[model samples]
Target: MEVMQYAEDALTINLGNEVDEKINRQLVILKAAIEKLEIEGITDIVLSYTSLIVYFDVQKTNIEKLKESLSTLDLSDLTDSTYSYKVIKIPVCYGGKFGPDLDSFKADGLEPEDVIARHSEKEYLVYMLGFMPGFPFLGGLDESLYKARLDSPRTKIPAGSVGIGGQQTGMYPFDSPGGWNLLGRTPIPLYDSSRESAILYEAGDRIIYTSIDEDEYYRIQEAYEKGQYTVDIEYRGEENGA
Candidate 1:
């Protein structure tokens, strides 16, 4: 691992240059260790696919002090899977208007069902949540389903729109301009400012997508709006031996 001054009030600790499970797990460990210290002036620890940015306040702590604190941390056994994760099952309705670019898979000799089957067949690791509020950057897209992004990006991608951009796949939590090819959409709200818990999933979590028909999509959407929908989740906590 390598550490460098990111800015006047931030530092970046790089775990690895490439994106891998071990690197991401190490990032989790590094962030947890920093938080455990509860050091003064550390305002926020922003994690990404390969590194973490520690934001600090000069009033409480200086760059030199924060760097010294980080040096004393125990970042050993980074490859050890000491952290736990919860699997969130998201229901999606693929193809048609929900995924106008669903046909883009055909260029790779894949049907929309083929794309759905491959895309939803595995659990995706939540690398980081960025690009927009509550928008998760998920890893583990099947190589066969990879497709280049659209030449002309859309100005307003619909909320809940699941899309694939180059090597990554994610959903839009709001109507935002994006270039990812739409694959489908989920009915559940990923981000709701009015809710007590704004975002349901975090960086360390894993999520699986299951194909749902249009009818079930509307049903779940309505249920969520009426405060009746609950996402299916399975926890594998380390402390509880789950």
Candidate 2:
């Protein structure tokens, strides 16, 4: 790991140079450790695929002391230990009006059912959240389904619309202009300011997609809007004897 000063009140630690699950896991462990410390002046901890950016208050802490504290940490235990994570099951309505770009994949020689099956069969990892509020950047997409972004971005992508851009797959949390290949949509509200906690998922969380019909989609949407529906989730503990 390499630590370098980022600004007057922030430092960035480069955990690895490439994006990999092991590297990301290390960064998560480190971020958790720093948060547990509750170090004075440390205001925020931002994590990327292979790095952690720590922001601090100059008035409360200095670089030397912070570096010293970080150097004393032993990350071996964290590296060896298994971590418990939440798995979220998201319902999606693929093809037709919900996914305008579905035919684009068909032209590429992929059947709609094949596309949906490939996408929903695997569990994905929430690598980070960016591009827009509550937007999750998920990893673990099947390479066979990889596709390029549109030549021109759409003026607006509806909230909850799921899409693929190159190797990445994610959903739009709000209506915004985007160029990802539209695959499906979910009814769950990813972001809502009225809730005590707005965003539903966080980095390190796992996600699984389930295909639903248009009628069921609208039903869930209505139930969700009425505050009667909750996204399905499973809590998995670390492996035994880890």
Q: For candidate 1, what is the TM-score?
A: 0.93
Q: Candidate 2: misplaced stretches above 4 Å?
A: 239-242
Q: Residue 49's C-alpha lDDT in candidate 1?
A: 88
Question: Candidate 1's residue-wise lDDT over 8-125, tens digit each?
Answer: 9999999888888767777877888889889999999988989899999999999889888988875674344368777989999999889999987787899888899999958998
Task: Give the residue spans of candidate 1 off by over 4 A.
Answer: 77-81, 238-242
Estimate every model's Cα lDDT from 0 to 1.
0.86, 0.86
- Candidate 2, 1-242: lDDT as tens digits: 69999699889999778877777677777888888887899998888888889999999999998998888767766676667668989999998989888778777788888899899957998888888878988999999889999999999999999999999899999999999999989988889887766987777788899999999999999998998987787887663124
Residue pairs in candidate 1 whose N, alpha carbon or C atoms collide under 3 angstroms? none
- What TM-score does each of the candidates earn? 0.93, 0.94
